[model samples]
Target chain A: DAGVTQSPTHLIKTRGQQVTLRCSPKSGHDTVSWYQQALGQGPQFIFQYYEEEERQRGNFPDRFSGHQFPNYSSELNVNALLLGDSALYLCASSSTGGGDEKLFFGSGTQLSVL
Target chain B: LAKTTQPISMDSYEGQEVNITCSHNNIATNDYITWYQQFPSQGPRFIIQGYKTKVTNEVASLFIPADRKSSTLSLPRVSLSDTAVYYCLVAPGNRKLIWGLGTSLAVNP
Candidate 1:
């Protein structure tokens, strides 16, 4: 079975520019979540998607948005990116079973904002 | 969401057991303790999880006391590859989880 997959392992962007990252859920998984990890820090939750609708969001700005396709794939869009936006964007997937299910994470896309 | 606290860093030699403890003083009754391991520039991987008592897996073991306010992740027979950051998370029904600076374990030869 395939694990979670993410596109654009690394990216470079300037301030005020927009970047889009993609994620494919693991086999037999339906839920997708996004996280951001800065240098020397743990990951912070961005949001979660289920049933093609956003279920819960973290304390992120409106510039950060996402979409979940019919096949359970996800896209994370960051607009007006700032220098601080440069970090590792991680995509995690889990099933729709009990809430305690473990999450499988992708290697993540390294975003660099200039 | 319950908050978790772990050590900043630890050093252990190979062939010895390493235990990383996490404290969640305000853990809810329904909250469960989970652990994740992450190497440099890589995504975190699930190590083990438990609600109470002891749960052992192939890679690690999770020990949660009856109070449920704290837990420990024990790695037996550590090696250089076992050097990574370990996170402890407490989630009730797996809602919005808050991750803190995890404990960084460095296994030496």
Candidate 2:
């Protein structure tokens, strides 16, 4: 089966610019979550989308938002980007019912905020 | 969310077994211990998970003590390809996983 897939492996954006990163969850999975990893740091939770609605969120700001399409694909949008926004944007997919909620991650999109 | 603490970095020779331990003193009753491995530019991949006692898998082994305050990830016969950052996370059911800095393991030739 295909694993979690993300688009635009690498991206460049200037300050105040907006960017959107896409993700397609693994087949048979329905929940999508986003995370950000800075240099020399572990991935930080951004938010999670289930049933086309944001179910839980982390400490990130409003500029960071996400959407889960009906097809289970997800998009992470960050507005008014700052240089500090530069990091690796990761998408993880998991299912909610039945089995354990083990997450499968994508290769991630590297966001470079200039 | 339970807070996790692990080593900043570790080094092991090829063919040697490596054990990385993580501490989560405030771990709740419902939380589960999960480990993830990450390469230089890739997303974290789930390694193994356990709640209590020991759990072994093809790639690695997880040991959770009865107290559940700490867990260890053991990788046997390490190779250069085994080098990566290992994260210890605590999640309550299907909630957001809390990630710590993680232990950076380097397997040398």
Candidate 3:
């Protein structure tokens, strides 16, 4: 089975612009979550989507939002990007069944806000 | 969400086993401990997870004591390729995971 996959492995955006990153979850998974990893730091939770609705969210601002399509694919959008928004945007997928939520991650999209 | 704390860096020889411990003093009874390894420019990969006692898998082993306040990830027979950042996370089932700055392990030859 193909693992999680993300689109536009690398992206460049200028301040005050908007950018969207896409993610195709692993086969047989339904829940998708997004994370932001800054240089030399651990990933910061952004939000999680389940059943086409946002179920959980972190401390991110309103400028960061996400959507989960019917096919279980997801898109993360960042509006009014700031220079500090430059980081690796990671997409992780997990199953809500079996009571154990182990995440399968995709090679993240590197976002650079100039 | 229970916060996790791990060492900043660790070093070991190629043939030696490596054990990295994580502390979560405020862990909840329903929370489970999970570990992930990440290489530069790549997303983190699942290593092993456990609720109590021990859980062993092909890649590594996870040990959790009865108190469940702490856990250890053991990688056997380390090699240079094992050099990466190891993250320790604690979260309940179906809940969002909380991540801390992980342990950077460097396996030397």
- What does candidate 3's lDDT look like per residue over A12-111, in tens digits? 9999999999999999999999999999999988999999999999999999999999999999999999999999999999998765699999999999
lDDT of 2: 0.92
Q: What is the per-residue lDDT of model 1 for residues B1-109, given as tens digits with 9 covering 90 to 100?
A: 8888899999999999999999999998878789999998889999998999999999999998889989999999999999999999999654467889899999999
Interface RMSD values for all candidates: 1.2, 1.8, 1.3
lDDT of candidate 3 vs native? 0.93
Residue runs of model 1 more than 4 Å from their true location after superposition: none
How is the predicted docking of candidate 2 categorized under the CAPRI scheme?
medium
- TM-score to true structure, per model: 0.98, 0.97, 0.98
Q: Which segments of model 2 are wrong by more than 4 Å?
A: none
TM-score ranking, best first: 1, 3, 2
Candidate 2 residue-wise lDDT, A20-84, digit = tens: 99999999999999999999988889999999999999999999999999999999999999999
Best by TM-score: 1
Interface RMSD of 2: 1.8
Label model 3 with its docking quality class: medium
